[model samples]
Target: MTEIRVRDLRTADPEDTAAYAAVRRAAVPALLATAASVAYSCEHAHPDARYRALVAEADGEVVGTAQVGIAQDSPEPGQGFLNIYVHPRRCGLGAGSLLARTAEEYLAHEGATALYSWVLDTPRNRAFAARRGYRASRTAHFLRLDLARGGLPPLADPPPGVELRSAADFRDDPRPLFALDAETAADEPGDVTAEFTDYAHWLTETWRHPLLDHELTTVAVVDGEPAAFTLAHTDGASRYASGMTGTARAHRGRGLAKLAKNASLHRARAAGFAEAFTGNDSENGPMVAINQWFGYETYDTEVRHVRTIA
Candidate 1:
């Protein structure tokens, strides 16, 4: 067997992104990833984020990839992440271990005191993480809805003084959407708390992302103010993903998030998307219930794993 070696991503080569995206899509089909998103992340990563993309090669073939970065925006210091994906057919060839070790060494040198990763909730995957000194933590569920066959709840009329709009409506200026996103993200259930304080960064990293579908993203407006929204992302084909669905603190009880998501899903299906995917932390009952209402079923679950860098 050829020795597997890991190296930093070569973003200048188009095949680099394609290979990395393929490995991720095959290892975890529930998440939506594209070559453009992969390249953008590598090229536009925040300076403080200290991002690095690593690929594992064996016998001249790319067999795995890992995204390593410091959580610079986290309230806590010295936090980092390493998400490694090995091609399904290439596991056990030392690709995963090599990539993980490379990621850990790099992040530690970047001042990271702890490392976090998401591993599929399966015996083999869990064992793999355990062997690398990681312990299990919180769990999240990946839900999927077959848009072509799922019985979607019909879209309902917004209440008086409320209106529905697409994200495209904010193309002129997305500061308002950015503000709402920051607020909601701060309150989201997660092990790593993120702070979205830079508008320019958000515009470049998220608003202009290739996978983001402005026409399919739905927003709920109350009296002309943005209240809740569901951001949609697509593969520009038959797959759709709910990038995020959130309601402003002031609009929590109004079910605006649900309304926005429903509208977005409707638009996606009508536009020919056949599959819809979304994920939620197991502790988030409200979002889980809402997804269930939309006929989304739990397709897979992943457990968060943490390791301390001593």
Candidate 2:
């Protein structure tokens, strides 16, 4: 018989936390993972977020982990998210089951009426979620680009009075970027709508995130106004991730998003990053096309699952 226990993460044990992140990166390549990111998430999560980092241990060895929390920023009350990951080599030890049960119980206690999760589209993964009563909602694709080998389109000069800049340049005043993000995010396809009205929250959760690389993040400015941007995140190693790429409604059709992303990718490859990753909703045709144009090939797919607790 195997015994499993769930417990919170301890920052003091950096190696242990890194092992958890390693498993996640291997299992979900689209997700940007690093020990620093894990620690920052736990420390900087909002006071009202009710976040919990549960680790599953079997026979005194860590085998799985889960992140459970209330969607504090959502306008809809009682909405929550839980993402669980178990080591591939350690499956069948009941670690995943223990982690999922603990996470669901925590969300329920926090008054969560609906829970959302992402599971790989593989048969085993899908079956696991189905067995737990989670119904499929939508699907997204993970894409990768061989920046070190793929032929990126030639960098076109910005139009008259337009220029390319880095997010670092706006350290003194990121409000312009915030306004652009708010406008673009409103048009993004998703089951849950997001209202980017809180600038302070965005600053804390996004701009200040440990993995965010402001210097490599590319932004397109037209007439000295931010019109589009491609945010970059890195693990300070060989992996780089495209966190979000969006253009203001007014800036669409001008190729501003492509320009920003191309500039960012060139910079990343020049900086020694070997692997680049990004994801897009299956319904987001424009973005999917943009990524495909950049030589990104579909590497994996995940289905969004939802369960109503109420």
Candidate 3:
């Protein structure tokens, strides 16, 4: 076996990272990937993000990569994440182990006390994480919808006092969406709780993300007030992704979330997106049920694994 070396990604040769991302997309079809996304991530990473992308090479060829970073926006300190991906054809060359070790050292040096990673729910993958001092935490499922089939529910006219609009309408003032995001994110299932109190950061990170398709994103309003929304993202291919969907606390159980998502899906299909993808925590029954109603099927499962470094 050839010796494998892990090193930080250099911006000089973009083709190298693009190839790395290609390997990831092939290994994990549930994820939305593109060369632009890879480059944007490296370019727009927050200063406090402490981001470090590592690529593993063996026999002079890149075979594996890992994205390691601190959860800088989390309210809790010392929380970090390290997700590793190895090309399916290169798994047995010790690339996975090398990437894991390198990521851990980087996180530890950055004062991270605990690290979380997602391992596919396959037998071999689960066993690998268990042997490395990591324990299972939570499970999430990736779902896919066939937009080309055109079986989506008919878009219903907004109820008498309700209106529908695109997220792009709030270009001048996105605080309303930011507020909704902060509330809904607090309820999401995760090891590290995110506090979306920084509106400026949200504008720069979420609203301005390269893949975000504000035109297709739907926002529901009642009595001229924002009630629910569905954020959409696309790779400019035939694929689309539901970035986030949420209803305000005051509008729960009113079917506003479903309404917004349906509108977004309808627009996506009309725009020629053949496939749509979304993910949800296994414990989030409401969202899971909503996705099922849209004909999305669970195509993959990932188990969150956590390890304490200190």
The count of residue-pair clashes in candidate 2 stands at 0
- Report model 3's TM-score to 2 decimal places: 0.96
Best by lDDT: 1
What is the C-alpha local distance difference test score of each model? 0.91, 0.88, 0.88
240-287 per-residue lDDT for model 3 (tens digits): 999999988888998889999999999899999999999999999889
Best by TM-score: 1
The collision pairs in model 1 are none
> Which scores better on TM-score, 1 or 3?
1
Candidate 2 residue-wise lDDT, 49-87, digit = tens: 799888888887888889889878678888889989888
| After superposition, candidate 3 runs with Cα above 4 Å error | none
Better of 1 and 2 by lDDT: 1
Error of 3 at 207 (Å): 1.1
* Model 3, residue pairs in steric clash: none
